[model samples]
Target: MPVRALGYKPVYDYRVDQLGDQGGAQGSILVAGTWYCPSMPEPLIEATSDLHAGRIDRETWVAHIAARKPYRLMPKESKDAEGHQRMMCPAEAGKVQCPLKPRSLGRGVHLPLVDPQPSPTRPLKVCRQRAITLAPEEGAEYWQALDYGDEQWQKIYFRPRNSVEGHANRRKITAWLDSLARGGQRPVRRTNRRRKTKPLGTWTPTGHLTPAT
Candidate 1:
């Protein structure tokens, strides 16, 4: 039977140690993390409701549900007014046809089959023109050499000869800006050595610090 995901749900409640033999430790279940559990049939309804309400994430919910044993609905022999047996599983009622074929075997049967021809394999061709190498801009090497102090600036400036280079460059620039915004460098402080002094009746300059009376 096909199981459709109606929504999210809580699938397990016990510690990892309870799972046993599989080698897991007991701990509180994280909503979005992976979990292992033994299969159960009833609590799945409440778990699914919790998941849809944002109380749990899909990972833990799925793990809890998967740990439970699968339920199989067998078709009943009783037929309705239309002479059709009602579907045992409501989810599959409208879509799937019930198994109605009788179990039997006849005396003689004839069978004929032919072998299929194998498909032809073709050799893969490589184009030298398509395999172009990437090179840095003329001034890029100079700027990288001065800024990074490395001759390997070619590796940093050059990129794969493809459409993704622009996107990659944007990502690199964004990362650099984020790092700068974090204030990773320390600020430099300036020190003063000047001193102030006072004369007999008025203020005066002793060394660098002098006041006019």
Candidate 2:
């Protein structure tokens, strides 16, 4: 496959160290066509529900995060200690109360917005133009950029290109998107689990059979 768009099914990466089936880690290629990180949702549901139900305040929630194993608020110099960049971690995190600041919470910690800002700049290697639902009337400026100089095109889309075969790849992707838009085919969400039911009994010479028999 030449870096085509992802289907809507989730992909599971199995791990042995973690207990439970599939190691409880799963990821999905979302409708926007981005690969989401694999995560275990089991531990989060209760805490999330409590937070949303207003049973716990933000301060309490922050404390809960620190309480989790392997996520200590200990000093960076401590053995196996890890923390957000430039944030201070107390030498005796458990013994003393650690002060909470906006910067202390690292990435992926969602908070209610008091002031909204534009999204942070993507890493140089990441694509600025994401997979999106195509519009039939999208202009030539958009399509032409897909065939730009190799370096510029790679930066924009975050993919490698060939001098001879690059145009063909762009055309293929463009045509695929166009067909989807023209046909009004929306992306459908899919789950990884297959349905299971008891097998129907088979007839036998001895007698009518139940599934157990």
Identify the candidate with maximal lDDT: 1
Off by over 4 Å in 2: 1-45, 71-213
The residue-by-residue lDDT of candidate 1 on 20-48, one tens digit each, is 12221121111112211112133442454
Q: What TM-score does each of the candidates earn? A: 0.18, 0.16
Clashes of each: 11, 0
In model 1, the runs with Cα more than 4 Å from the true position are 1-42, 64-69, 76-83, 86-213
lDDT of each: 0.29, 0.29
100 Cα displacement, candidate 1 (Å): 28
Worst lDDT run of 10 residues, candidate 2, spans 23-32
Worst 10 residues of 1 by lDDT: 123-132
